[model samples]
Structure formats: C-alpha cells, structure tokens
Target: MELPLDSPADQLLLAGDQVLLVGSSYGGRPLAASRGTAPGGDAVGRIAPGPEVPKLVLRTVDISDPAAPHITATLEVEGAAVDTRVVGGIARVVVRSQPASLDFVYPSGPSSEQRAAEINRQIVEDSTIDHWLPSYALEAGGQQSAGRTVACDQVHRPASFSGFSLLSVLTVDLAAGLSAGAGAGVLADGQRVYASPENLYVALDRYEDVPVPETAAPETIPATTVPTPTAAPPASTAIHKFSITGAEPAAYLASGTVDGLLLNDFSMSEHEGVLRVATTVGAGRWGNAVADDGAPVSESFVTTFAQDGEQLAQLGQVGGLGLGEQIFGVRFLGAVGYVVTFRQTDPLYTIDLADPANPAVRGELEILGYSAYLHPLGDGRLLGVGQDATAEGVRTGAQVSLFDVADPADPQRLSQLTLPDGWTSAEHDRHAFLWWAAAGLAVLPVEGATVSADGSAVAPFSGVVGIGVEGDQLAERGRFGHPAQDPTCPPGPEPRLVPSDDGGPEAAAVPAPPATALPTTVAPSPALGGDEAGAGTSSVGGGSSSGVAPAVVDSPWCQPFEPPISRSLVIGEVLYTLSDAGLQANDLQSLATLGWAPFA
Candidate 1:
C-alpha cells in the first residue's frame, strides 16, 4: 500500500504512544508518548506559492497533550536529519533545505520539475536555518501546524510582522488543535540569508559578483546650421511627372521624442527641394507667473534637408517669451513662410517669414481663444480658423479670423466669426482620456481657389463670417459654415452677404498609373548652372531677413524653397513637394505669384 499519497491531503494523527507526521513526504512519524499516550498539544502549518508559479508548504500540530511529551518536529535533508539538539531546555530541530530560486519571467503555467530542482540546489548551497527558530502553533481551523521558532508554547505572533519575514515563531498556546496556514520563521543571527516567497532562503551577496548584460539606446542625429549658397542663373524648367494620388509617403524623416510637450499643431512646407516643417509645441510647463504676464513662451525648431537625405538642418530654433513659445501656427502665406503663436493675454501671433530660415515677428493679434489652423489668403493675408467662446460661454466650431498682412511687420485681425447657436463648445474642448498630442483637424488648402488656372469657385471659401482689412477695422461679416446637400435640412443658412464665386479654386486631378508594374525610372534633368542654381528665395526677389521666406507671399502650387542637385527634378510654374519617397508636383501656373514646375 503506497498510503495513497496522491489522494486529497488529510490531517496527520498521533495515536497513543505514537507520533505520526502525516503528509511528511515520507511515512508518518511514530514516537511513543512519555505516558504511553499521544501529546495533548496543538500544531499549525502554512504554505504560500509564487505569483506566477505554484508551490507547496506543510505544517503539523500536537495538542492532545497525551502526557505532554516534548513535541519534536523534524525535516529530512536527503533522508537524513542532522544536528537534532536541545537549547535552553527546548528541542531545536533545524533542517537545511536547498535555496529557493525562481524564474522571474515564466510562461503562464505550473512550475517545472527542473525549475524546482534548481531552486532546491540554490537553497541547500546558500542558506542557513536555526533549529531554535522552528516552532508549532494552533490555527483557526483547529488543525496541527509547525513553524520556525517556539514561543514558550503560548502567545500570538504580532500581525505587523506577519507575512513580512520568512522567519517566524509560533508561541504555541494550550489550544485544542493546531491550525492550518500558521507559518513561522526563526531569525538566527545571520546577515546573508535571502528570504523567498516559498519560505526558502538564499544568499544574495554570493550572486552579487554575477555580470549582467547592458541595454543600448537608439542612435539620434543633432541639429546643425544650414550652408550658404553662391549666386547663379535661374535653372531651366523641366516637365516633372508625378502620380495623381495625393497620398503622402509613410517613411519617417527626422524624428525625436520630446517629453512633456504636447504638439498643438504641425505643418509641412518645401524650400529648395528640402522639406521644412513647423510645429507648435507647449504643455503644462507653463503656469501663471507674474513674469509670464499672460504671455505664451517656448522653443521650436525647423527641420529641413541639408544634403541628399544624409544630413538635416535646424533653423528658427530660438527660446524666449513671445518668440519661440508664442508661435501658434506655421504656414506658407503664398511663398512667404509665417509662424502663428500666442501671448499669455492675447491669443494670436502672426510671424512674418519673409526669411524662411530666420522668422521675424510681424504682428501679434490678441484673439479671444486660440487658433487651430491658418490658411494663407495670399499676399500678406491669412484666414485663421478655430473656435471662440459664445456669449453663452460655449465654444462654437470653426470661428474664422480673417486678417490683412498689407504690412508684414504689422498683421491685424480683420474679423472674427463664431459657430451658430445650438452647437456646443464642449465638442472642441480637450478630453482628458485622449492624449493631448494626437491628431486634430488638418487644414488642407481649398483646391483650385485663386491658385487654379480655370479658377473654379465651387469650393468652401465662399463664406466669410469675419474679415480684417489692411487698415480697416475688424468687422463681423456674418456666421457661415459648410452647406448641407441633404434635402432633409431646409437649405442651410447663407451667412455671407457678399459671397465670392464659390467655383474659383480648382485642383488638377492626376490619373492613376496602370497597375501590375514597378515604379518607373525617371530621367534626370539637364545639368544646372552648378550648385549655385540651388539659390532659393523667400519672396520672388530675394530671401528675407530671417533667411527663410515671407509667410504672406503666395505660391499657386507647392514650390521648393531652393533648387537641389538631383536627378529628380520638378520644374515649370507648378508647385512640387519632395521627400525621401520622391516628389509630388501640383500645377499652379495661374496663381498670382509663387508658381513653378518640376525638373527645372
């Protein structure tokens, strides 16, 4: 009879003149009681497992007081009990089991035999348990349990130290029986014993000499200054072909993570075949300080190509109040570049980028709230679109702010428009759950408007809730929004008193290339007047003081800031956008100024 070890566990029993330790991983112990009867004492036991792995524990009890024979607990080590001795008139039974080691990152499952063996080996080679530390006590379940130290066979263990240390002593009381889950440890004077969840001990100091691997960080390139170009004749115009699809390539250019800075908005522009992007950066860092005076301050950098995708240049990266931080939006007012930031008190900043590389502060208009997108109306003017607080204190959607930049140095707000009643401002407010720097409304140019050759006027630019003339006072034209085509909604309100031709702007749609083929090999353009041909202009005449471009200038289509030395050419008076994935050319020969072809 194998004693049915695999069956559900049962409490151990000590018959008269017999000490039977059941579930002892061995045959129950049979020690004759002093008076030829079982001890009338109680015992306790407890076992806790690992978080990701399962383990086991066992404890015994003696409460019958069968003649009150001194109870002795023994744990076999390799089937051999060593150093069974008595200290201070009490039997100190200490068994040295192997160290308990566990795999920190284990799969979701039970522990393997190999893992348990390893843990046992570590414990045996590295741990030391004191015999006097072993004790037995009774538990609530009225079962026998054994623990680390003896507590004069009386008193309860303090709850504060419970479950904290592997060493515990149960002060056995004259209870009826031992209790289950009663664990204890004996703290013998030693410093190297590493406590483990399975009640096994190991020496951490021994493993301190083990070498661990180090982690490596990803590489990053820093920003540098742009090089000066030499004077040369304007390059020849070439017909650069582009796929009609307006999809942008997914390849990442220069990228870095800026913690604590929520990106308010971002836009991309092209100069000299290099992609220059402006992003409004800010966040909780700004608290109301008297010195702040209700002004927005921060730092921003312009990322652009230096050479053939190998190097990058950073410009307009200044740090100060109302300079770098105040910039709200960055857009190309025509060919001229401009940055829109805000002040603490006022809510608008119109920066003139007559110089693309170096931007100069033009006008700072104090709007009620903040601007979401800035659309260039060409020639020192821009259409700022966002929401404003209504009299009811609600934010209406798409409040249009028209401005006149007749003087790039002093941009004034022409007018402000608000959303109609019934619409809520909460829709525009930020949600705490969503990341502040995620996606928002993208301000795309209205196709064909004033920049198209046919100049179709059937676009969304027909309404003007507000308009700010160069020298005129800002006036509220009327409220307006996209008219619904659904017949259910009685023709939407037409708020513009003097609506411009809606069919003015037109975009040339390109035909998609035939499928089942790889990208076609494009022919390089003819030699230019050398690198000097790379000269770029912020305006038609020259670059501005900022070394970039004027934000108010207009370009019929996307044009490169300057010419680049590449077999890839974009020419004619068409606008061309280039990146690592290649180029996209928009034909804008009809726009007032700022139009160019690819491969020129």
Candidate 2:
C-alpha cells in the first residue's frame, strides 16, 4: 500500500515500528498586504510577488506492518528544516526562518498628505549618522483614544538589512505527539551540523583582518635594512554547544571560538566531557590562496575544550601538525584522537586527549595517501577509507588502510588495499561504510574499472565490496550489484533494393532482415565464494602468509547506468542497501538478494 503526502520526504528515520518523515511544503505571496489593509497604491501596476514561504512538515508513520505503512500523525511548522536527528523518542530539528519581505507604508487620506511630504523631506535630508538609526519611531497620540503612528527616518534601505532571519531549534516528542520550540539563536546562515544523544554542536566560521599599525619612519633610514610587513591573524572557528537533555528541550549552553577553520562537521568530536576540534589554521578561508597574513600558510592543530559553567573554556592545544598541509580526517575515541593531514604525503597523527589540560601528539605516521574518513575498529585499530596516491602525491584511486594503533607511540599501517581508478562514497560520507565487528566484515560502495589480462581497464561496475578483516589481515569476500537488462535500439525503416546507376538488371532485393527476439533480462553475477580456508583468509599482517585471492565478477548492472547506491547498513544477518530506485536486502554471508522495497 502506498500512502502519498503533499510533499516528498527529504529525510526519514526509523524507531521501533514507527518512521518519521520530514519534508518541505511551499504557497502565498511573500510580501502580501496584512489583514484589513487598505489597497491605495496602483495594485495592477505592481509586479506580483514570488512564491509563498516554505514550511517544514513532519509526518509520523506506523510501520508495524512492514508491507503497508500508514501515516499516524503529522505536524507543520514555519520555515525550512535544515537538519534533524532522532534519539529515542526525541527529535531535534533545526529550522531557518527568513522574513517574507520588507514593505513600507504609503500615506493615504487628506490630512495625511502634508505628513507624507514632511516624511519624505526628513528621509532625504538625513545624514549618514541619522541613517544608521532606526528607520522609524512609534509614538502614541491622545489619552482618551490612544492612536499610534510611525515616523519614517530613512526612505529606503537594502531589503536584506531591513529584516533579520532566525535559526531555531525545536524538540518533538514522538510518543507524546507534542513539539515545542527549544531555543533560538542568531547566525548569518547555517552550515554543517553535528549532534549526539545529549549535545548539539554547530560550527560557524569567522574571519577578521588584523589591523595594520600606523607608524612614522625616521628621516634617514639605512639602505641595507628593510622592514617586514606584519601578518594578519588566521580565521577562527566558533562552535556553539547546546544541551539537548531534559523534558524542557535544548538550550544554548556555551560557545567557543578558536583560531582556525575546521574541515567540516567531521572534524569535531566530544568525549569524556571534552570537545576535541581538529582544524587547519593559517589556511585562508573559502580556499583563498593566501592567508590574511599575506603568505601561503597551512598548518593543522587540535584543540581541547571543556565546559566551564555556561561557557566552554580551552584547556590545551597541540599545534604544528602536518605543517603546510590541511586536515583530512579526524576521529575521537575515548581518551585518544586520530588526525589525518595531507598534501604531498598523508600524516596520521595520534593525539592523547586523556589529559585535556595538556593534550599532546603521541605519534605520527607518514603514508603515501590520505584518509578522508576514519573509523575505529575497536582494540586500538583504525580503519581508513580514502584515495591512493603516487610518490608525487598524485591521487590515483580509492584505497582502504588498516592501522594498528595498540601502541600509540608506534602506529603502523598493518595492511592497505589499493583499488586502481576506484572510488567509494565512504571517502566523503562516513555513513556509507559499514563494519560488522562480530562478523569481521566491512562493506563499502565501490565503483571502478577492472583491469583485464591485457592490462586494459574494462567492465566498470558499481556495487558494494565486502572485505573480511580477520585479526590483522584483509580479504576480499565478493561484490554484489543489481540485475542488468539488454539494451534496446529503436526500429529502423524497412530496407528497399535500388537499381544500379548503369541501368543494368536491378540488384536483387535486399533480403528482409531476420526477425529479432526481444531483449532478455540478465541476472546479476553471483558473489564470489569464500575461500575454503575460511572467510577473509587474506593475511595483511604477520598472522597468515597465504592470503586469500580477490574474486572478479562481471555484470552490466555495475555500470553507472544503474541507480547509485546511497546508503548501506546491517541488521542481524541482513544487509540493506538503499538507492534512489529502492531498498535492497541481501544475505550478509553470501551477498545474495533477499528482498526489495521499491519507492512509490
């Protein structure tokens, strides 16, 4: 059963037997007249306003019956939803609201004629100082029957400055079917957002130019001496923390702005009451070539901050990490943090955060390429998904690295897999990569060209690659993709025989083309069988010398012509892969199709 709504769902989350869907709806003129307003101006002459303001809608669905989900309830709120996260029965959503439009009142009636002229005169005569003041002032007239009028200060101003927008956080209780505004804050706009079960962090970038000092030089300066120009300070990152606990909803707890800019939301992590931020300072903002200091600068640093009352106070900082390089990945686990910075080479740095007041870099390992996303594999091992690079730092394709960090002071890359001309969504979005510790399996959406025996790249395929991690070794289990279908070409006109130019006997009529059969559906290639020794039998470290060989599967379904895989997750022994086309469930062990749910 398909249940259609007014708007397409943009995001969804499942909790128990319920699914929450959030979408946007749009309708009315943005600058329409208020209720009971008299239309005096030339209504016909004015241009029509644009589409109505956008509103966010939340729909709750009961999915007890997996085959036929039904909408249980819905709630609407003004503004567009930016980001949302659901923890248990609580849903935290961030919405951005902008003023409809800026409109000024025009005078009407006989007595108001003279007042209108005076208002125009004041607006034209106001100086710069007065222009900075409020545009209008409200005053009360008479005692018995009070009347209010607004005195205009400026006749015109930019629409953007005339009104202000708001960034609001709202909390919704799915079980109680109630929602309330948690808190409101000011931001020029919103960017990437990060949230945990108990805290929400918003990263905002800030730029400020250091003022150059004015000085007078001496009358006779030495010809051999040259004065150097002062450098400007680097950009800063302001992280605002909000507490999302309690029945009252979330509220801003504190904000800490440090010198540098974070790569993105993934560069921040909070653990053990301390927030660790990995940022690249000295690097100009928005990809500017040079910093405000007027020099090419690049330096990575990690700072630790702790909550102090209602504000976050900086405890300590470690700098000079991967100097001249930018940060690529950051992961915080317990009292340890891993940072990947790269330019010509990838430098994976391990920072000890156990002492927040004095955080220090414990170890550093230099590798050929960099990891854009880092995941902890428990027991002091880290999994990295990024790109492979040459000695000259030329990125070739996607690569996965397994690191042994049991000894923080001596981190080593246990094993690395290089997929030539290949890429994975996990490099940019960590959620795309799934790891099952118990099963010793990691699945990643891999797309790339396969090299043939003749050293030619062929048979490009898009699908999930299952890598089995046993102890310190890595083995390729198999690959799975959607089914394929033969191509279809439009029918052409029937062939007709033509006489020769010499006017000789006409050439025999071109034989009618043989009737062709309809194109047949092609089943997807089967997954490679596991090695007889065991699953993930490839040895990447000292454990097993006989490594399991990778399996090759050829299927047209792996081409880009098919829907791209967007997300993947594992539940029990079933692996679920979602794409624009639909959801596909596969057996975790063999990568065989189990079920499918097509989008309606």
Candidate 3:
C-alpha cells in the first residue's frame, strides 16, 4: 500500500501486559504496479511478486519483562500490511496484494493500447483465487512453515466493480505463539479503516459527478474485473461494514455512503446505533476550475448515519466550518465532537451530538497555531499536539496546547508550550503518541537538531519527550535520547527543554542524575531553530539525513544505523520504547533511562 502525505504505521499491539505485535497496519493507496520479467515470463504469465518487493515482516514480542523484552515469533506475509485490530484476545491483520506481471516485454512493446489491455485481461482471467490473496510464512516454537495462504471462497465479482486486487483479513492468536488465524478476503480498495468494539468499517472514496481522466481511471468498469479509483476527485466515500463479533471471519454487515473523504480513524465514530463521520466536502478534482472568485472551495462537515436494514442511511449533517481548510485533528468523544482546522490560524470547533439526528457546531475558538492530534485529559480538558506558527501561519516548530472545553460553546486555551524549529512524528502519527493518565505524562517521538542557515545539522538528536499535564497547565517533564546507531556519529548533543521568547513557562528539566539515579541517557542538547524554541530531537530512521532516510548519507547529522524509538508503552512504573535497534525502558516519573537491550 503506497500513499503520500499520510504514512501508514506498522502497529505495535500490546496484549494485556505481556506481549506486543509491531508491523504494517492501517491506511494505504491500494497496490502499485511493479515491473516484472519479459513477456510469458515468470510473472507475466503467472502470479509472481515483484523481485524487488519483499513480504511484510511482522515481529511478535514478549514484553512481560520490559527491561529485557524478546521476540517470540516472526511472521512474513506476501503483501502490504494494510491494517490490524485486536478484540476478544484475537488479532485481525489486513493485507493488500496485487501480483503484477512485471518485465512483461510484449515482444518489443504492445502494438496498441487496446492490445496491452487485452493481454492484461487475459492474465487476470487465468489467475486463480489463491494467487490473488495474501500468503504468509510463520516462524515460531523453533519451527518455520514453508508457506500458507489466506483461505477463502470463490472470488465473486462485485456488481459495481472493484477490480481484481486482493485484500485479506487474517486472524492471529498471539497467545498461541504467532499462528496465522482463520482468514478472509474481499475484492475492494479503501485506505481508511474505523472499528468499533463489535464492527470494522472500510471507507472508499467515491467519484460520483467528478470527471476522471481516461488514463487515471480504468478504461472500462470491466465486464467483471478492473481496479477502483486510481486517481480521482472523491465527492463522497462508500462505507463497507464488517462484523468482527465472533469466531467466524469478519462478515460483511452493511454498506453506506457519506459526503466527502474521511481524515483518519478519528473521522468516523460509532455511537449507540449511529455512525458519525467528519470530512472535507467538495474536494476539487477539476484541477484548474476551482472557486471562480479564488476563494476556499472545500468546506468541513460532520455527517451522521444509522443502519437501516442493509444500508447505513444518512440522517443529519452540519456543514460550513473552516471555509477553505482541511481537518487537522478530529475527535468524537461520546455525545460531543472536536474538529481543528488551519489556514492562517487554528480554529477549534466543538460539535454537539447529543441528538444524533441534529448534530451541530456548538462553539468555536480561534488560535494562532493548530493542533494535529487531540487527547482527552479527563475533566473537560484536551491536550493538543501540533506546530506553533507565526501570525502569518508559517509553522515555527512543535507546539503543545492545553484546552479548557468545560464550556463547549466557549472553549479556552488554558496553556501553551511552543517549540521553535524541531519536528515530531507524533504530529501526524497517532501511534507515536502515548498518554499515560496514571502518571499524568504524554510521550511522543521527537527529533530536534540545530539546523544551520545553510541547511546542515549541527547536533541532531532523537528520542521521546515527556509532557506533564495537570489541570490546565503543561510542563516539560524530561527529554531522553536514543542509543547511537554508530558510535562514530553520536546523536549531536543531548537536547534540553527551554521556554519561548513569548514569555511562556520554562520547562522543568529532568533532574540531574544522583548516585541512586536509574540508568539513563546522555545530557540535554538544545534544539535551536532560528528564534523559535523546541524540546528534544528525534528520528524515524535514527539520525538519518531524512527523518526516515531510505539510505546512507555522509553528512553532519549522525548517520547512526540504530533505528530511533517509534512506539512506546507504560508498564507499571516503566516506560518502554521499541525500534529496529532494540528496546529501552525508562523510569516513568523522572524519565531516567533504566535499561536498554539489543535485539537478536
């Protein structure tokens, strides 16, 4: 699954307090076409994967001992890990695959477009069901399976047409030591997934009145096969609901349509017997022809639906919020909803959903910066994570805001902590954020570096930033760095938290280590970005030139091979983070590095 802007995460599932599953899951742009062998070659005439493409690698870990967690099993599946969900102790992994006919040299290229289309159709019709579905290999109990396929029934064509791509939902029982559980398949494409305790929803963008170019969409709907929307203006989205209630495979329950496209999992929420989704309507697909007056064309909306017979019928909707901007953050908490949109500034709008059929915008508050993620802090308060921008809307760096929504119609900004010139994955990836209520700490993966005017990094650092929240105030509890991937290129400097020039409160630094101090990391290295101030530095691909650089680079920044910590968990008094390098545990309260272990 390939997508831009949004990076689908490799999920880490923590089962109770003993285990964690980390790898591909959630949001993708279907499958991409890769080059194969020559005509009538291995892949051209058969169902073979691209030579350069590898199957999704999943690791099942035992975290019972946080300080020394170990991998219990590894499963490799042939496809992109689309998503995963755990309920009633069983985990469901969704994967999408498109066995391509790469390197299909049609005897010095096909004669014409029609001829190329004909050849492709033949390849599809001749392929069997197993070839289109996901196949997996599991290694556990000191044994490895040669391979296994996601079993399902005959591939039936959808009446509306959804191409011949394969998407599978595989069940896995972690307690059973990484066994590939009962699996099922559907011939559809959707990047977003929303799940309730009893239901799983897949939302596919719909191109109703939009005119898609012939090259972007399939030449024809296909007599019975072809892909869905490849590139088109989505006027709405079709929701396909599947039941994950019992032992049987995820059974399709119903279907419905909602105006505009969904933002993320937060875009849809299932309450009582209704489903509410927030989206940006009128997403311009007609490239040049936007609003005639050069105004913001797309608008934000909250629409509600309820299952009536076999369809999710639309009931009510509220629109006209954030005239021209898209949603930055969306959170539906029971009968209330919060949507954040940004352009020149941030507008945090509150929605009243007490009456599902009459959802309306209750109140709104405008601020200088916008929040990308929102977390409930109990007692009518919300924690927002995003960038602190200038009055002109230029993002300075990372910003943390505590909002008092006690009065929904009149929300207030309780406190603000703005960091000038650093970046954090937690801004876009929710999986990278952890809120431990018991300890009153919010931790997210952050990377800070002193970038010179010429664009070279002075001392780049990466790790987690702990934010202490109580009532309406926010404090920087501590900043921790990761073990260097290369001793030669050490994480530039340990980052220290500082206050902004705007007279904001200074961060209470992590106390100096005493003789009794738990094993910890290096000292603080200030993250300096021009005149703005930020907290700690971080890395997706630890210290890589690009946050998640795909290759090696000989630069000023640390080119450490160690992958930076990306996901975290709070077990008892210890905070554990995971990365390709290994696992590290920290003393929860003081953010003292307690222990670090390398993987096998």
Q: What lDDT tens digits, residue by residue, belong to model 2 across residues 301-410? A: 88988888656789999998977678888887878888998876898999998888888999999999999988888888998999989887899988889999998888
Error of 2 at 432 (Å): 1.2
**Candidate 2: clashing pairs of residues:** 232-293, 462-558, 473-540
> Counting only residues 3 or more apart in sequence or on different chains, how many pairs clash (N, Cα, C under 3 Å) in candidate 3?
24
Of 1 and 2, the candidate ranking higher by lDDT: 2
> How well does candidate 1 match the true structure in TM-score terms?
0.28
Off by over 4 Å in 1: 1-266, 280-309, 321-328, 342-344, 352-357, 389-398, 419-600
Give the winner by TM-score: 1 or 2. 2
Candidates in order have lDDT scores of 0.30, 0.64, 0.66
Candidate 2 ranges beyond 4 A from true positions:
28-52, 102-164, 178-188, 207-234, 285-296, 308-310, 451-457, 485-519, 524-560, 594-600
lDDT of 1 by residue, 1-600 (tens): 022233222233333343323222332223322211112211111122232221122233343464454333322121112112222222222222211231122111122324444444564455443412333333334334445332323222321221212322211111222232222222221111211111111111001111111231111212232222221111111000111111111111221111122233234444444334443333223321123354433444333322223123344432332442344455654435455444332335444444555655555555564465565554555666555554433453445567776776566777664443222221232110111111111112111122111222222221112122333333332111111111122332333333335644543444332222211212222222222222321111111201122222122232222221111122443333332222333222211122222322
Worst 10 residues of 3 by lDDT: 527-536
- How large is the C-alpha RMSD of every model relative to the true structure? 34.5, 13.0, 13.7
